[model samples]
Target: MSEIRTYADNRQPLDRNWLHKQWRHLRLWRRFLLQAVVRETHYRAHFATTLLVGLVQLGLGIVPILLLFGFTQEVHGWSRAEVITLVGAYQIITGLMAAFVAPNLQRMTEYIAEGELDGVLLRPVSSQLYLTLRWINVAELSNVASGIAVLVIGLVQSGASPNVPQLLQAFVLAVCGLALLSTVWSAMSFLAFWLQSVNPIGFIYLNLVEAGRYPLVFFPVPVRAFLTFAFPVAFATTYPVQALAGDLGWTPVAGGIALSVVAVTLVRMLWRRGLRSYASASS
Candidate 1:
């Protein structure tokens, strides 16, 4: 009884310590987001201009789909509404990437090139977390809202009243899509450690992500395989839209979740390897 009591007491401290750490992390994240909000709102005119430009860009993105559908009622059995939903999903994913991931990726390149990463390394928190979450483009969040509006419009137009289960699946798939894209972006950013100038790679990556706005069925088998596995951008937009339509099967959903997990793990491993090879500016 005494031994069991001792074990329980020891475990209690461990559990409390873990919870405390989590609370601290949450607080730090909140503080960072708040700072971002303040910084973004400081320049009100600039914020409005950027927001307007973003909305215009999003609106223009839909034009291509409209033109394509105007020529054909359906492309590979994907109706206009379905295609619009895919585009909306693409917009949402890209908005998230721009707001959260792109700024950090650009900064990471600068840090690596200028050896400014040393300051980040000295911080007590995880350097990756600090670097990635330190900045938020609050202005770009409006694009996410616009994307949501587009998605709803498409769903309503298509007359797709997804049941609760289908909606839940779509939500889960959307999260997985975001996670998968984030990991891919991180992997690309890690290339900065070696190349220092990854502009070409970044350009190619952006183009590939743009392709996600369309269904995979439009591509040839080889290209489909590549998009499904090598890059997996289809998981970001196509799969989620299909889930909304109740057309996605459990196997693909499971595969998407598993792929996201694997991608995250691989990217983390790549980050560690890059750090090992990182020659600090100070060094």
Candidate 2:
């Protein structure tokens, strides 16, 4: 009985410590996000230009789909509305990544290059959390807004209104998709530890992500399978859009969840190894 009580007591403190640590991270991230918003507001002209550019990009992106639909009623059994939904999902996911993930990874690379990362490493918080939460490009929210607008339009035009359960599943899948992208982004950014320039690598990743804008159905069976299983671009756009458009089924969703878990585990291991390789100038 005494041993049981002691074990229980010990577990309580560990659980409390974990919760406390999580709270601290949340507070820190909020502060950092607020700072980023304020900093962007100070650059009014730049923000305006970014907003304009994002809107223009959104408009231009729809052009190819429009042209394709004009030529044919459906591309690979995907009607015009379904394609729009996919595009909208792509925009939302990509816009969010630009708003959050890409900028942070780019900064991480810069920090690694300039040796400024030494200060970040010395901080009491998790270096990964700090690195990711330290920056934001508020102008990219314009893209987010544009994406939301496009998504609403697509959903209406599709006339395939998902029920509550399907909508929830789509949301969950979308989050998983973001996690997968972040995993890939982190793995690529880790390369900065060994290389002087990772822009070319980043470019490749960006283009690959861009490919997800079109329906995976357009690709050959082998290519589609590779994208779905190997790279997971299909999860990022196609699957989530399908979920919203109607039945996505459970198999793909389960696969995506499993992939996210495995990817995150691998990314953490790689990140730790990269940290060990880091030669901090401050040290």
Candidate 3:
């Protein structure tokens, strides 16, 4: 009770000490990552298998794009190079999701269902942060490398040499996009609080992620609007590629950042609300 009260009271203030708190949290995260790495390294064959599967998946993802481009020069104003760039960006985002976000959220759903979260809630640290960062899928990192390679190929094919500012803009937008995706996953996983099964929900979310691989213009105006404002799938893949291709402006970047902030805040609140409804196994 005292530790919980101390944590709650500390949350009331955002001062210089907040940075120190965050630094501590970061150190904790580093330790967790290191431990996960050590555990992953113990299974060399499994790691190799995951790497092979990731490459196979990457190749499969690119095949349709190549086939489509062969039929037409462009799809809804997106050139072959731009489309490839979008796929590359989508690969990177999904790689991060698979590695860092999805595995944690999937486990979180199980934790909530099985009441394993009781242990996490008793910890002195932030439960949400701890839950999200406790595990690392180190083997999935190969997909990130594959995405980078694909992104470079797309850029080279496009013949666009992005400047430092463009690269920085793309990086920021990518981060924002990732933040949005993570929040969405968190929000969906939190549904385990009310629902008996969340696996289907998670499957639906993965299907939605596939939509991020294409140009937003390919969809209807309603979907384009939804992908931009409501769901913001385009922010993850399209906007970043646009930024990389020097086609994006400051407005979209600002919007992406703002939306990410709002999404994360809302999901954090949702997590707290979900916790209040959580019933432990003993209950």
Candidate 4:
């Protein structure tokens, strides 16, 4: 008979076959975030320049949203400030994707084409994690800051008195939604392992994500339904706006968190499956 075993602090036996330990992996990501902060400091001038340009574009993007309030009380069922929140949320997530996963994945594909992936695979840590964070666009931090400021301004302009819980609810949902969105991008990029010519596909996916610039409600029913269920983007773009706009109740708010967890799970599984075909020059 097989014997049961368990770790001291853990209630159940440690599943050794799991390949990656999620708790430890998550801690590492937190550490990586800190490392990114320190790294950002070294490139102050470049980061500042990038931030300036991004902020200019982001500020310009706010015009249409603010104008909607002047021309009409609401835009596509969302009031002005609610629309601002939507834009802010979309900007935050999009900037994160561009400044992190997109660059690295683009480079990864180039490296694979040039037979440079061997160096990545030879590292001591997991190749997946290493490949995912090969480069960081420090300027994107400005986008996060600007997004939060916009959200606050949105609440003030909308005359919404969001209590601590409401504020926390919005913040937490936005972060999780971004995580899941990035994971999905990473998962999609890992398809390069098989597809070999996935750069075009990546561009297409990026274009699809651009559609998130507006609230999902503005979309036709079929598009809204597909993005919500098929692409899981409605959680990323619309739910936070809904929470602030008072269109959706707590159910969709909770659903965003649940969707994030499921998204990360699916991405990791897909990544592992692709890893099987990993054959490097050195190997």
* Number of colliding residue pairs in each model: 0, 0, 0, 0
For residues 1-283, write the lDDT of model 2, one tens digit per residue: 3644344334334225878889988888888789888999799998999999888888888899999899999988898888888888888889888888888887766788788888887778889877765777878888878887888888899898898878877888888888898888888888888885676788888888877889888999999988876667888889888888776787778888999999989988888998899887555
lDDT of 1 by residue, 27-113 (tens): 888998899899987888877987799889888899999999999999898999998888788888898888887777767777888
Best by TM-score: 3
lDDT of 4 by residue, 160-226 (tens): 7766666666667667777776777777777777767667877877878876777887788999887
Scored by lDDT, model 3 comes in at 0.86
lDDT of 3 at 33: 81
> What's the ranking of the predictions by lDDT, best on top?
3, 1, 2, 4
User: Mind giving the per-residue lDDT tens digits that candidate 3 earns over 1-283?
Assistant: 3644343333444335978888889888899889879989899998899889989988899899999999999877788998888888888889888888777887866788788888888877889998887888988888898898999999999888999989988999999989988888788888888995688888888988888989899899999998887677888999888888898888989998899989989999998898888878655
Highest lDDT model number: 3
Please identify which of the two predictions, 1 or 4, would achieve the higher lDDT against the true structure. Answer: 1
TM for every model, in the order presented, reads: 0.90, 0.91, 0.93, 0.79
Rank by TM-score, descending? 3, 2, 1, 4
What is the C-alpha local distance difference test score of each model?
Answer: 0.84, 0.83, 0.86, 0.73
- How close to the true structure is residue 130 of candidate 1, measured as C-alpha lDDT? 74
Residue pairs of candidate 1 with colliding backbone atoms: none
